[model samples]
Target chain A: MNFYDGLTFPAAGVIPFEHHRAHTPLYYGIQFNTSGTLRVRINRGREHTLTGPVCFITHPGAFFEYSLAPGERHDFTFFCFAGPRVQEYLRSGLLDLTPMPAAISREHKFVETLRELLRQRELGNYPESVNLLESLLIQLRRQTQISAFLYQTPRLQELVHELRAHPERDWDFEKEAGRLSISTQHFRRIFRRHTGNSPQHYLIQLRLAQAANRLAHSEKPIGMIAAEVGFEDVFYFSHLFRKYYGIPPKKYREEFFV
Target chain B: MNFYDGLTFPAAGVIPFEHHRAHTPLYYGIQFNTSGTLRVRINRGREHTLTGPVCFITHPGAFFEYSLAPGERHDFTFFCFAGPRVQEYLRSGLLDLTPMPAAISREHKFVETLRELLRQRELGNYPESVNLLESLLIQLRRQTQISAFLYQTPRLQELVHELRAHPERDWDFEKEAGRLSISTQHFRRIFRRHTGNSPQHYLIQLRLAQAANRLAHSEKPIGMIAAEVGFEDVFYFSHLFRKYYGIPPKKYREEFFV
Candidate 1:
C-alpha cells in the first residue's frame, strides 16, 4: 500500500548531494553518528550540524532538503507515511512536523523500535506496521519536546508522572502549582511548553486515554469506567470522549476490542 | 532471505481442499476454534478433527491436506520456515515435527505470542520477528509434550518447573526420582517421552539456554556464567556449549552481543 518503508543505513561512501521534494508526504528520519558529522537543511532553515542521534520530521506538503559534507559519513533509517490519518495526527499535534531537527544521544530502545517497524514491512505485515508506526510517532513526540530545561524542572515531571499513573485522582491546578512552589499561571505556561498541552487539557487527555485502554482491554461497564477515571457524570465523560475521539466510548471499545 | 512467513486464518466457507507440492518448507499452524471445527489429514494419516485450539507441524517434503465441514467456520494462523537453522533446530529436538495433528485446549499465552509475532511482521521488523518466533517454538515444545496425564501429575509438572527456574541446582536423577516415588530408569523414560529429552539432557539444554541468554545480555565472565549454571568445570561447559551451538561461549557472546 506504500504506507511505509525502512532499512538500515547503507554502506556506500559519502558524496556531497542534495534532495528536494516539493510536495512530499510526512517524512520521519532517525540518524545516528558513530563518529563524524551530518548537516541537514529543512525548508529555508540554516544548515544544522547533527552529531550523535538526530530525529527530523516534515509535515505533509512541506519541502524537504538534505545534504552531506564531502567524505563525511552517518548512519540513518527513515519512514514516510501519506494518508488521511497522518494529516489528522499532524493537525491534532500528536505528531510534530516542525521543520527544525532535534539531536539527542543514541537511544537504543528507539533505534530498536524503528528497526522493528522495518522488519514488519519485510514480512508484509502491513496492519501491524502501521500500528507500530503510530506508536513511534508518540515516542518521537515525547523525545522532541523533552529538553534540558524540562529535566531541570523535576517537579513538573513528577506531576505528569503522578497524573498519568493515577488519573482517577481529583487534580486541582492551584493545589498542584502550590505543591510545586510555582504560581498556577506559571505552572500552566511551562507545562504547555513542555507537553504541548495546558495542565487541564493534558489531564483530560490522560483520563480519556486510560478510559479507552480499560474499555478495550477490560469488560468494565461504561458508567463504571467513567467513574473510575474521575468522572462524576457519565454523560459528561461520554460527551468529552466523543469530542476528542470522534467516536463515542462504546463504539471505540467495539472497534478496538482485541 | 525467505526465513519465515505467517498469516492469520481467512474467513471462507469450507469445501474439500488438497494442498500438495513436491518439496514444501517446514510448516507450523496454530488454529483456534472460535466457532466451528477443522479437519486435517497428513500424509495418508487418518483424518483428525481439531475442535479446540490445535497446533500441528509438518516436516519438509511432506504432503499436507486439510478441510472443514460444509457450513462450518474456523479460525487459523500459520507459519513456514525454510532455513538451515530450522533444520538444526529440528535435529536437536527443540521443535517437534511429528505428522499427527495434536488438538490442545486454548492457551491464552500461546495465542498472544503468535499475535505478537504477527504484529512484528506487520511492522516489517524481521529481526525481532524471528527472535519472537524462536521463543514461540520453545513455548510450543513445552505445550506439545504436556499431556493430560502430565497435568494430573502435579509433582512432575512442579519438578520440570523447578528445573527450569533453577538450573543451577545440583540435581541427581535417583534422588529426584525417589522424591517422586519412581525408579530412576522410569523417571528417565517418562521425562524423555514428555519433554522429548532425557532429564539430564533436558537440564543441560536448559542450563545452556540460560547461559546463552546471560552472555548476550550481561557482561559476566565465561567462567562465572559456567559455574552459575551448575558447571563446576568451565572447560567441560565450554566443550558442550561449542558442541551444541557450533561456537564456543565467548564466540557466541560476540556474535549476539547487541
Candidate 2:
C-alpha cells in the first residue's frame, strides 16, 4: 500500500562540487542546487545557468552535462528514482521535466525536504525517504506554476516579497505604482496578471494568513493578533477569519493549537 | 520522479460504523481501526477480533469481510491504492499483507498521519496525501516489528509501557521479577528475548532517550534534566549520554535545540 513499495533508489545524496556528464542515465534524476551556480547543458543544447534555489529533472537516456566554476564548491542534492510508473507520469503531464526556478527565498522547503530525504536514505529508512521525495516533487511542481508567473517581472516579484515579509504594513496601491514608475491602473493589471489577485486583496489575504498562523501557534489575545496583522477592528477580523477558515478565531485556536 | 505519480487513489477517508464484504477487491486496501472492535474474516478464515489501534492490508482478489457489532459505531480510516508495484512488494517481502496490532497507545502517529492524509486529499493536495500514506506505511511497518515482540506476553508488555511512561522511576530487576512471579534469571532472559535488552539496560535507554528529548525541547539546565531522568550523578549521566548519542549533552542541546 506504500507509494514506493517496489521502486529502486539507486543513489541519493548531497554532493559538493559535482561535475558529471551522463550520456544515457539508467534512471530518472531530480537535482536541486543549494548554493553557488550550476551550468547544465541538455542534449547538446545551450547551457543554462542555475543560481540560488533551483531544480531540474532528467529522464533515462537524456544526454546532459552539469558542472560548476573552476575551484568552486557548491552543495546540491540529487535523487535517482526508477519505476514503470515514472514513464506513465511523464506521459500524463503530471510530472513536468523542464528545469524550474524554485521560490527565490532561502526559507523554501525544497532544500530542506531534499536534505531530510537524504538523511532518511542514509539512515536506511527507505519508506520515509520515498515519502519525502513524493512530497518534494509535489512542492516543486506547485512552485513551478507559481514561480513561472512571479519571476516574469522582477519589480512585481520584489513587491510581492515585501508584502509577504511585512503583511502588517499599510501598503498603498498608488505608492506602490509610483515606486514602480507606472499608473495605478497599469500596476493593478500587471500585479493581478502575475499574482492572480489585486494589490489590496492580496494584502488582505496575506494578513489573514498571518493572523491564522498566529492564532494556531501563539496564545496571544484575538484582538492583539488582529491588530498585529493590520486589522484594527476585532469584529471585522473575526468575520474575515470565519469567512476564510469556516471557523471563528477562538475555535480555530482551540482546535489547532496544541 | 515522484512516487505515486501514476498510481490511482480510488478512495481514502474515515468512515464510521463501517461494514463491508469484498469477494474480490479491485484495488489494494489498507484500513486502521480508530475506536471500537472490528471483526475481520480473511479468505473465509476464522474471524479475528481487532481491538484498540490496529491495521490490516487487503490486496486485489482477496476475499474478506469486516464488520462491527449491530448498532455499534466505530471510527476507522480506509485507503485504496492501486499500482503495478503493489505485487512486487508483496513478492519481495517488503510489504506484509497481514493484520498487525499497532502500538497499544492512543498517541501513535498512525491515526494522526491517516487523518492528515485524508485532509490533504479532501483539499485536493494529491502529492501530499500520497506522501503521508507512504510515511504512514513506514510507521506501521516499523511498529509491526516492535509490537509483535512486545505483545508476546501481556505482563512484559505492561512493564515496558510502564517503563516508557515513567522512565525516571527507580526500577529494580528483582522487584519486577518478584511482581511477575518469576525467578530473576528467567525474568532477565524473557525480557531480553522480548525487548532485545536486559531490563536494566532497557531502562537506561529509556531514561537516556527522555533526557535527549528534554535537551532538545526544553531550556532546563543539564544537571536538572539529568536528575529528572533519575540520574543523580551528572558526570555519569553525561558519560552514558555521550556513549549513546555520540555527543555530550551540552553539545547536543546546543546543536539541536532551536
Candidate 3:
C-alpha cells in the first residue's frame, strides 16, 4: 500500500545486504556514495530503475528488490500510500516510470514545486505540506500517465458505479471485500493501495463530492441531499460538509443561491 | 481562539451559521449578503449592529460576541485565523478595520480560494483534499498583513530566534512546551492558533528552509551541514531534505552551488 515501495532513495543507511521479498506491495528505495556499488535483484518481476541525483517517479504494481554487495553501503528514503484510486492510476499507465535524479532542477518546475510543498510541510506548515504533497502526488500520477488506473480497473469501475447509484447506502471493507472474495486485510490494503482510502472512506468521499456538485448546481435542501447521499442525519451531513468545506451547509447553500 | 466573534451577519431562515471563539482573546469577522440586507447584533457587553456581505479580519486579545439576525440571507462564507502574527498585525494597524461591502470582489481572490478549498475537502477528496486546503490556508494568511502578530509575541519571538540561532535541532514539542510553562496541548493549540503550527513542526520547517538556502548557495558536505543544523542523523536528515526539496543533500549542494 506504500507508494514509496515503488520508490527507494537515501533516507536510511544502505547496509550491504539483501533480503528476498521482505516487503510485499511496497516501494523500496536506496542510495549510495562512492563507498559502495549498488546491486539489485529483480528476482520476482519487472521494474524500471534510474541512477542520478534528481527526482523520478515509481509506477504502481511494478516489483523489484535492491541492495548493495558485501562491504557495501547505500542510503535511501521512501514511504507508501494506498487506496483503490492509487491502484487505478497504477494500472492505467498514467504515472511515469522514469527516475529523475532525486534533486532540484530549474527545468523541472513541477519537481521544484513538489519540493517546495515537501519543504513547507516539513516546516510544520501542515496546511502547506498537505497542499503541496497532494499536488505533487496528483502531478506525479498525471504526468507519468498513471491516471488511467481508475478507468482500467473494472473492479473500481463497478464499485464507483454501484456507489454512485446508491450513494445513500453504507459501505464497508469487509462487505465489499467479501463481495470481491479477498481477505479483509488484503482488501483493505488494496483498497488503500489503489484508491488512497478504505472502502468506507472512499464511499463517503464519492458521496460528498457528488453532493457538492448538486449543492453548487442544483436547488435542493441539505436534508434531501443528506438523505440522497445516504447520510441518515442531516445535521451529521452538514457537519461533514462544514468540516470538509469550512462552511456550514446552509451557508454554502445561501452563497450559491440568493 | 475562534476568529468569528464580535461580528454578525444577516440570517435568512436558518442559512447555516458557524462561528468559533476563544475567551482569553477576541476577534471579529463582519459579513454581508449578496442581494438582501444582512442584520447583525453584538448583544453582549456592547450593543452594535451592522449589515452587508462584507468581511473583516479579526485579531486576537480582543473580546466581543456577534450574531447575524434572521432576515435576508444570501451566499456568504468566512473564517478567522489568528497567531502571534495576527495580534501583531492588529496592533500594527496592517489591516485597516474599515467597513467593506459583502460583495465577493475579484481582488479578494484568497476568499474565493478559501471557499473552493472548503468545497474540495467537503467533497471528501481525501488524498487530494489536504494539499488544496493547506494552500488555501497559506494563501489566506499571506493575504493578511503581519505586524504584532507576525513579530511581537514573546513566545513567537523566542521561537523564531531559537529557530534562527540553531538551524538543526530535532526539536521535541513536549520539551519545548514544558519550557513554555504550558501543557503540550496548550502549546500546540496556541502556537498553531498564531503561527499555524505546533512548536516543533515550525522548527523543522525553519531548519529545512535554512538548509535549502545553503544547498542553493553554499558548498558544504551534507553530512556536516546536517550536523550543524542539529540533525544528529545525517542519513535521516538528508532523506528529509530530499523528500522536501526533491533532491538529496549532496545533489542539492551540487545543483545550486554552481
Candidate 4:
C-alpha cells in the first residue's frame, strides 16, 4: 500500500477534538489530530502538553489519547509511515536530535516559512500539500539535530550565541574561547566535532552568512557593511568578502538585491 | 574533502555575473517555476528557451550558462551535492526526468522552501540548513514518478481551454479523444501518462484547484464556484467535493474562503 494513500480524517465544522487511534495490523494505533490543548499520555506515561505547535510520532501498538481546552483553537495533521527506518533510528539511538538554529531563532523567517507551509497544507492541497509538509518535517528534523549539536558542547553553544549576538565583531580571538568552559585547544576540537568548524572558521562562516544576507536583502555599501561586521580595514574586508563569496561585495548586492 | 569544507569563491565588488558563473558549479539544475522564462546556452552549442520550471543537471566538465529575463523573473532554488547517490542517479538515466506532476509540484515547494532556508543560513544555522537541503533533494527526485501518475493529459488541453473560456455551460456529451487524433483508450493512457490521471479526473482536479484559488483569494460562493466549473447541481457538487476532499463545501468556504 502507498503511504497515506487511503487515509484521511474528518475536519468538518469546528473540530473541537479530533484524535486518531488505530490498531491497524500494518502499523498499530490510529493517528490523531485535534485542536486546542490535547493532553496526551503516551505508553511511556508521559503527559505531552501542546500549547501552540506540537508533533510526536507514536510507534506500533502505542496507546494514546487527547483532550482539548474550551475556546482554545487547535488543529493537527498527522500520519504514520510504517518502515524499518524508524526502528533502525530508534535502535541506533540516532533519533535523539537537538534543537536547530532555525528553532532557536524561532521568531526568524525560517520558522515562519514553515508555519506558512503548514497553514497551506491545512488548507488542503493534498498532493502538493503533502510535499510541503514533508519539507517542513525534513527541516524540523534538521533543526533538531542542530540544536543537539550546539547543546552537545558548551563552547560551541556560547560561541554560536556570541556570533548571533554580535555578528559585526571581528572574532579571530582566543579570548571568547577562554570565556567558555574549556581550554582553547579542547574547545576548538569539540566545536569542530559538533559544528565541523574551528572557532575562527565558524565565526567567518557566520560573518559571511550575515554578509550574504545583507548583500541579498540590503543595499548597504561595502564599506558600511565592512564596518558593521567589524572589519576595520576596508580593503581587507573587501578582500575577505570576495574570497569568501567569490564575488565582490558590490556585485553580490546588485545581482541579488537588484 | 568536505562537500563545502573550504571551497571559497571570493571576488571583487557586487558579485560579478561572470565570477558567479565561473566559481559555483551547477550540480543539479532544474527549473520549477512555471510561467517563467530562462535564456540559457550550454556546451552543446545550442541556444535554448525554457518555459515553465525544469531541473537541469550539468556535469562538472560541462560548460554551462543561463540568465533570467528582466520582466520574466524566475523563482527557483537548487542544491549541489557530490556524493555516491547523486552520481548513481546521473549514471542510471533516472534523473533525466520530464516534469511529471508529483515531482514538479514537489520541486516547486522544495525550491521555494530552500530559498528561504539558504537566506537564513547566514544566521549561523548550518546544521539545520544542511539537513533540510539534504532531504529536500531527495523529495525532489521522489516526486517525479508520483507526479507522472497524477498530471492531466495533453489530449485534454484544447477541451480544457474551451471549458475555461466558458466554464459556466454544462460541458458534456462530448468526446475529445477523437478530435485529438487518437482512440479514447490511447488518449486516456497517454493523458494519464503525462498528467497522472484520467481526463475527467484532471478536469475535476483543475476545477478544484481553481475553485480553491477563487475561494481563498476571492469572495466567490460555493454555488458560483460550482457554476463557474460547470457543475449545475449544487448538492452533487458538494458531494463530489466531500468525497474527494473529506469535507463539506461549507468547510472549504470557511477555511479557505476570504
Question: For each candidate, what TM-score against the reference?
Answer: 0.36, 0.43, 0.39, 0.49
Q: Is candidate 1 or candidate 3 better by lDDT?
A: 1
lDDT (10s digit) by residue, model 4, range B123-178: 44454454454444445544554444334344355564575555455544235676
lDDT of 3 by residue, A1-258 (tens): 011122212121222233222222323222222223433334355443433322343333454455434443433323223334444434543333443323322325454554564455344444444344446555544332222434334475477567657777867657776777668887666556555556777777667756766776678877888888788988888888776555787665554343
Q: Order the candidates by lDDT, highest first — what do you get? A: 2, 1, 4, 3
What candidate 1 gets wrong by more than 4 Å, as runs, is A1-36, A58-73, A83-85, A104-106, A148-154, A163-171, A178-186, A189-258, B1-258
lDDT of 1 by residue, A29-131 (tens): 3333333455666666677776666666644455556554456554545554454555556566666656356665546756766777777554334444555
Docking class of 1: incorrect
Q: Candidate 1: how close is chain B to the reference, as a TM-score?
A: 0.55
Sort order, DockQ high to low: 3, 2, 4, 1
Q: Which predicted model would earn the best lDDT? A: 2
Task: Estimate the overall C-alpha local distance difference test score of candidate 2.
Answer: 0.70
- State which candidate has the highest DockQ: 3
Residue B196 Cα positional deviation in candidate 4, in Å, after optimal superposition? 7.0
Q: Model 4: which docking level applies?
A: incorrect
Q: What is each candidate's DockQ, to 2 decimals?
A: 0.02, 0.11, 0.14, 0.09
